[model samples]
Target: MITKEKILERVGGEEYLIRHLVPTFSSKVRKKNYKSIFSEKDDKPSMSIYKERGVWKFKSFNTGHQGDVFRMWADYYGLDCRTQFKELLELIDQEMCLGLNAERKSIVTPKSIFPNSPTVKDPAASFPSQTLRIEYMSDYESFISRLYLKYWLQYGIDQSVLEKFDVKQVSFLSYTANSGRCLSFKYFEKHQVVSAYHISGRVKVYIPEIAFSFSSDPYFKGQKKSFSYKNQNKDDVFGLVQLPEGNLDYILFTAGEKDCMSAYAHGFSNVISLQSEHQMPSEDLLRVLRSKTSVLLCCYDNDEAGKNASKKLRDSFGIVSVQLPEDVKDIAEYFQRYTPNDFQLLLGYGVQQVQSITVNPIDTHRVRRLSNTKRSKVKSYLSNKFNFRLNVVTQEREMSTKRNPGLWEKINVNELRDNLDRHGFECNLDLINCILKSFFVERFNPIEAYFLTFEGNEFDDGKDYIRRLAHYVHLKDPTPFNTRYWYIHLKKWMIRAIRTVFEPEGINKHALILCSPKENIGKSYFCEFLCPLSLIRYYNSNPVISNEKDAQKSLIRNFIINLDELHQLRSNAHVIKTWLSQRYVNIRLPYQEDEITASRIASFLGSTNDVEFLRSDLGHSRWISFEVESIEYIDDEAKYILEKSWEQAYHLYKLNPGSGELSKEELLELSQRSDQFTTKSTEAELMVQYLTPSTKELGEFMTATDILRYLQEIVGITIRLNTKLVGTSLREAGFDRVMHSDIKRYGYFVQKGLI
Candidate 1:
């Protein structure tokens, strides 16, 4: 019972065996280039050894000879690796004193083979594999290794079939044995040492890379087993992941992974394996698979164990067994012996045809008039078979349509009808609607769903956004402008604007206004570009606030509202402020039964040519005004910066929900800065010139009417005699109103200046 796994453990590892058996013919083994050890006339050094996925391998450019340590040993001795693999293992054990065979006591010295070389032994040979421990390790290439793929291709499992099932080509794989030995294998054309079998579950099965007829080989006589597994998981069902979505007319269950792949190679896509014939599928798995296919059939190997297991499954779960011909061992062999069409013919004879299960045959004209009882039965059947639900955020109906189930996709009415027709249920649009009404429906908040779709790189701490903003837009705030201060506030405003799309309470009460006297500076384009390309449909450039109904509808549908002409809104500053301050809009939408309140997700951005866009002094805080020197058109770099800024803002918002909100100090600073954008207030200017703050001991109190009378008479100024304007101007000049109880009115406490 001496095996290669046990001998490899005793000899440290395969790497040691390669260094000992194969000597450097031209130069030292540590050099980059070495003479070919297999050829006598290899005058040029063209062979070199390299490690791939922890397995030591060598390649010869001169002769195109390449393989792992075991393959190299076989090539050096001029032996066929497939038939004489047992001899290869025995030779290594005899050379390394591995003690695999107690009867073999003689050990050969390396100096005898290579006469000019010294017999040096590595001290750490016993634990060489431990130096690079590969536990649950694997690597994938674009295609399966050509050498390993060549073996399976014989059974008709081509590249497309393997790729469809996600069966990857393992470049190299290493695993630890139960005896604490780490064994690694690499795939090469010269001789593939191991095979990698990828199934649906978490198991990784490795077998002999090349299948050999062991009847003539004395070492492997009477032995058919060739499997060594590593990193096996709880899931036993193989090929389940490769099943197509929705219920199939029929699905064939095979005995092993190879057989399952072989069935798929041939047009049988709906096929799976339970790892072995004896291992019955779990009850829950069987129930799920039964719902996914109309008919389930089993095709095991042509042997006693396979037949007994097939019968047991048929008796217990009522699975139909497709017995193979006595000459063929399994489906893989059957496909090799006969054509795919032959196998298809055999399947029809072995498995019974699936019969329709409908209680009544419907006439084409009466499809719409199906009885309530029959319709209810169809609905119940669909509900029990598949999970159907509606995504309120995406506004689409979807059903669990995956082969293994649990994967949902948008429902296509026509596709559903076709699938139903195949199942013996004559369905129409009306009937399908009736059946869908019974499906579970649920709603989700659109705002949360919209923001959750962002998946990309986030900018660093908003500084990148502030830098880009400073480079693009310049604020006309007073002389000696603090670029850092204004840009930081603008960045905060941008983040808050983004949050406005997710928050329904309308936390952002301001609109970003870009002003420039020159025309066509890309101002409008920048405003439009503020909305991400993914949500470009939700960006409204031609916004009309005059129509209250249309405005409310826009608030619900659009995420970004571009106020095109900012100066035109100056006439309706009061109304604009009222509209901007609304948290939710209550309006009757088209087709809506009655008035319904809708949460607003729109954040406003505007562009105007007029420098003096702010006409009202009271609503200046609601507009973040900036005079742009220039705005560049949308490009790749600009798009990246804008996208990353939103991503970063979202990241910060999720981490700190209130990160976008301004503090009390910031609000006060913003209010002070907003004054520079406001138009010159003539009334406030005249009031400040005519009035002064009262001293603590000496002051006179006057009403707004009295102040207006003094400005028209005493100051000799022609002005409108409006008491409310006079009172507002006085307050704007830093005057506090005093409640005159004696006079039953409110007046300001001030003393007249030089006037």
Candidate 2:
């Protein structure tokens, strides 16, 4: 018996508490935040847990649940406070016995809640400890009754199967003097019986009304009731001993002992069963199965509960499931309904047949060595000798009178590379790189051609597309002369989005920035619409990207990386500019052993309220900025229209991708206008307003201090700056220094068209 204080001390405090409780609740601790592991869609941290005052405390933002560690653990196990305390005490006692050689300590008995009662030991303290014991029958012949054998035979379990598993029947007397019988299935471990499962065959005696009035009815006199022993080692599966002694090609798992016997009778020697439908195999048993068997077949009953259990097993262990015929439910019923030959045919039909490929390790290693210096030779060798080909399929197919949308399916290059590596291949990096590069090039050509087809059509015209999109989102064009100007900006964005999908390499060379100082302009929503939902990775909070390693993390697969709430990022424009211009990026996935160079496939999109977003020195080549002023609420109708339009554009692009080129004049105008609208800094803005054009005369030379004062007086803007800082700001704003010979002062001259 242990007290709460003693238990806490023995279990090594709150960290241990958290470690124990989190797994029990099917939660995971990632970067100190506890989150649900069951759902992939739930990316947010479910609870914030921390240790305080020598105890663990947690608050669940998802459920509005807050409590100390003990209460949380109790809630997870569906236990009341008192019962949970008792359980915790027992758990701590077990841990102390295992981890430390602590002497037996007296438990603190809590005072009774009842007013008159005294303190006493917890009720759980008196509970019997479960132990495994094997009981042998002294009268085996007498116990194996005719009724018991007949009962089993009715269920298609013959005497031979019963003898093979060493099952028995027993009669016993209960405390109530009622007589009963049960069929017992003995469980063996390493050829020794450690436990047994008993199926009761007891019937209640119904006395007549006159006999019930008597103190003892004649029918019930000297009757003995039956009792079954509970097995402590319940984790072990029931029929492992019956499994064949060599490598099994496939093992059929059933839901009960009878099912196991039925399967064995039907010529499935490689069969195992759980104690009941509700019990799953233990980890040790699963590991053994994995090592010995090539395939696992879940042959549970056809009922709802059994199907659910089978699915759970399939997901957890990656096993294939076998469903019975419509009329049959369990293995016993199936044996009753069909002949052995029919059962074999049904088993063959139920098995999932997967094609297997075998590779020679020496040949793979030789090919890998050849790939490093002679990539083309290796490619030719693999193509001719191994019949390797990059498989890419069309994105549409004719179905009846209408065309159905098709999916992009290609040979998995990573899996191929892994297979090569597993076969003792060296220089796998070079081999994989060459193969993937070829595959991408081969795959993307058709996609690029499909996008180009939309250029000439009226419905897919760049201007018409943008106009429809703007109207759907309720966006008003800023300039009256050409709503087409806004359309041109949007067209550039559409090209970028298309390129992100079709061009896997160098797609990160530019990023799109949607800027607005006001909220509810649908900036983020538009970003989501441009990319597929599966390929969009969101950063609700800014991630560290100041270094190469940090920058590498942002290139997650082929995703459109969304840097939402861009104002929170402490990174300056120069870092972002460098990141966006890279053709290839270094990636070190968390589980990988070495860093690998991957083609830059991720496209960055950021939304922010900051008007002057980038540094003055950073050029506009890598950024396409859009200033959205429309702040109207988008209703369901508008959302549907937007989705439909975007889908049309995507399908058109996939059908007819254009030649990957942009008009030089159009691109230059769009870049300049985009820079003016969103990318210019405060200092650049002021220079654009004040500086004279290059055709006009240059402004007068003045000291930095004097220029600052003039700007303050003219613009009604106050800025605190020293001469050095002012000079730096001016240089960044495209201003140059000129000498005033008479005054002997070197002051900055504001060149025309500097902005």
Candidate 3:
């Protein structure tokens, strides 16, 4: 009898036992985490097992229970302690007995867990004696009957090829004195049969009714199935044993064993086949081919599934596809009709034809013309006329304006060369270089290309520009404000917008927040007018800006990040603040493995219908607010004014690019005036409604719990409120607190005052 320690040592370790047993216990397992959530229909193991220290441990998250590998096995089978131990011993003994071979002569531990271990001698002696049995025959008549030989000859395979591969007929179950015969193909590893496939000769009505059985079948006999006796190192590629042992010039890959045999009969001795079309060749087989062969040719059947598999193999290993004649379906069928010499000639002609047309000719002048036209248009539009840039940061966002194709069309050298060759033009490197130099401008600093031009008209003066823009803005939202207030802010915004295209330097960066409690107030339209619709990146709602990584991803390729109909931004207000203040940020693209430090070229602009959008800590300096009160539809007159205003602003911006800055006193005063438009939190508004300035003399004290109860019960507020949130809002609204002791608990004393 083997002790527990001896059993563990003989089977390598607990990890080996679990690895070999997991598939038998669970149907589905996640490769990344090795976690399996089993179904209740069968006795499945619902847990994740992993190696800890020197032992294997498992934990079931569903039940919050943990144990070792032995316990897991017992739990899975509902076995008692004595029976479980007996079964474990039998498993180890079976593995050691089957694994014993003449070459190694012992079962060595796996290299991953135990690197240094002295080999135990005579492992086969520890279990019941057994031997592998193979019934060899002398010739075809003695091996398979004449009927079997005829059946195989129908597929164009001769008896000599079958005898060379050692095919035989065997019987598994018998009903009469003479048992029914089935063809058996032994799968060999190191010249020893590890498994045998038994193909039945019984005919069926359906095309897929060819039944087969394996020596490794679990239900072959009424006995407990164990994986320990199975072949641990089976070859993925079938028919590998028949190939000659030397370097091969080429290897033909087929989809089935019969096809491989047919190819060999057709004088292609160096051929291998996958078990099925879906089963790709293993990496080890591919590596051998790469070392010994120069070319790999896939000869799959001429069906949709076969063609798809051929393409998959081609993509994986850069192998070439060998096309058969349209009349023939596969290698076996082709061999039946044509001679071996004829097929060889056909393959040679195909290879020569492919080599002759290796490089395609191109039209150099056409590519040069397309590149030049695109580049000239972009430069003239940005430098002279007003053209907008539209930056798409994510797929979920839909921009209101069309994307500018000219700005994004960059020239690729390799693509240009290929196009030239296809169009029959001789490729000239010097000519391509000249064209590229004319179109592409290199920037020394990241801030060189700061602004994208708005596609609009030119204006005469700043005053006329402001009036036309104000009329256009008024057409969208007719809420009238002080004339001077509207003029100064509108003028400042236009200057900033124009500068974004020209000289975007030496300015305090603040995100423009266009907010109002009402909807359809033309806030988004106003932003569109200030910058080109093409140059703006639009987000329908607030993005989850939880960390600097998220911020970098969102702001990498845009000039203006526009948020529309934003309702709330309480969670990541600080991250947004950092994004607004930094002139440079670290960016990492999805495809790139490393991060790149680049200048922050994009500005933030957000429109919201929520009155309580910002948290208390988001200071007013990083944001500029404008309230849109009412909206009106644009008529012909307003449209004309808008067009003329855009023309005026375009000319004004070109004449004087750097003109959008306010004095410190003016900025401070503007901030104070904008504060009136700031949104107040619900708690802050409640404090203002309930507390009076004269109530400070009353000097009332209340516990946080009592205050919470009053807010929830008396006020009938449905939202869950905690003391931390309440206190934060009250403090932002300018309320002072003092410590107070009650009979039951200590609380806070608050002097009521209007905020």
Candidate 4:
């Protein structure tokens, strides 16, 4: 009672049998050249089935379809073909019987075993099925389709069997979003047609690629950056890219590599960021959108800074900033807060993808520091206090209380003058004027005049001023140059400038320091150290601080200058190189005032950016850019030999000094000789030796974070730390990369004396 349908279930169908069985098992065994399972060429399917007492079974396969030729191999091998067939069936069930492919034996109770039509006792179980489940070596649409078309008769859903696919049943799955592009499936229900999912109203996230290594550890933590820090493949992400030739489009930038990854999952193209090396200019983005005209939409942060940056980018890209309701911020929020219809209206169909910018302006500390209202107060306070006759100018542009444009020098000088005058003693205007007029060299201190004014008095005004200056210097703004040296120098210079206020050229000689309330909030370190250092120089009436030859002193100045710009910088290495290489680069000085006049003290000492530019210009002559950790607390008691510390430090700087602006080549040579001075481990030639990166310390300091914290401590930034959020503090301190390393190093140094 073997039936045709029953046979077909196992051997595919008539087509499969004719191509494999018929030729190998024709009427005559000798004529058909029949071979046994042991025969060299017995792999023909004609003899695939075992026959004993009208019973048949299958044999295990050799490589691919070996079991299909089980009988032939069995007969050739002269073994019990039935046993081989049974063994093959068992193996097949174990490997492929799971899912819908599990075999359904004949309820067909075969009625005959004739050649024309395989006999079966019954036909119900023999009838092919309408449903089927299949798995491929990989998820590939074409491969899935090919497997179905080629083997349809076996699954009972082939076109010849079922005739069509029930497409609605086709569903895809993946661990991540963008891993579905390679999936393809179709369904066929004997005489019925199936409809696919409707695309009219739904937003489908399209997966552009499927290439991810299955991770074993479910709780694995990812690297903080966009790229894999260790053992990462480029293919880890589904890169859905828009070609450059697409030309001109308004680009909306977002945040995080994952955000971009998710958008790519949706198949929307044109979004790009740090994922690729080629940075598309705003003009280029606009150019592509020219043909397919559409207003650009920025679904970035709803924060004030985010809005400003979005607007700024829109302007640069020649696009309009689509305003969202006050409550909604990003695309995800747009959906969560509104109905589907509203969301669709907001995000028009067929638009470009979203990408978040990484090297953005807001990330700079200076920008963040200046943006706060209370922080800006410092800029204003100092500005008006310096010069009551003029308004202050600050970089915190949103504040209305910022000083007016121009008159920075007059303002800063006036503030210091007013403070001194309040103490009941008049500023020594003439002596200061004389000192500045004759101060021609790169190095000199004018502070001796102040000390001289109070030389015989214990309640000395000069000492009090120096003390106040020191207190603020301890405030430690990250940019220590100004905090330690320049602030003090500027204060003294302003006092001198104001004393000669009636003299020619006295009105605009110094830069202004406009302070808004809380302006120096946590940024007091710079004012503390740099200002004091500057005082030690300017207050001395000694022509030395500027030209101090202490190898350590020069290095400290270079470090301070670098840290300031580094505050406003994203690429410290690149900026440092440019600075050391003597190339000019524009750095938008963080404005102290929101608005400014033509003649304002935008930067009293100098713009951090300008200072950065000069680092390279004077590399060899002024310094070699040696790396060092900023000192947390210099032993003031041990620091100076009162009579000779200045002279000793000065001598160190003059040792291998070059005159004027030293070239890169000269700097390299000097640094080489300095490091190789007979013994590098002992009695340092350069300060780097004495100031080690704690064998336990980071290469540049107590981890850049601790150094930044040290800087913040000295300068003061209003940062609140969780007792447990060590990582967060390190991140904010700017030593985000090796924060743990830094903290560990710091601890190690204290415990091991490695620094």
TM-score leader:
1
lDDT of each structure?
0.63, 0.51, 0.50, 0.30
Assess every candidate by TM-score.
Answer: 0.45, 0.34, 0.36, 0.17
lDDT per residue (tens digit) for residues 350-441 in model 1: 55533422222333224335335556556656766776765533345677843546677778878888877888888678878645533233
Best by lDDT: 1
On lDDT, the stronger of 3 and 4 is 3
Candidate 2's residue-wise lDDT over 451-488, tens digit each?
45544544634434445665433333466534555555
By summed lDDT, the worst window of 10 consecutive residues in model 4 runs over: 223-232
Better of 1 and 2 by lDDT: 1
Worst 10 residues of 1 by lDDT: 122-131
Off by over 4 Å in 2: 1-467, 476-482, 504-510, 534-550, 556-558, 612-623, 631-719, 722-755
Looking at model 1, residue 428 earns an lDDT score of 77
Q: What is the lDDT of candidate 3?
A: 0.50
Worst 10 residues of 3 by lDDT: 200-209
**Per-residue alpha-carbon lDDT of model 4 for 298-386, expressed as tens digits?**
44556665576555554344333445678865444444455546634555531433333223444345445644643234333433433
- Tell me the TM-score of model 1: 0.45
Candidates sorted by lDDT, best first: 1, 2, 3, 4
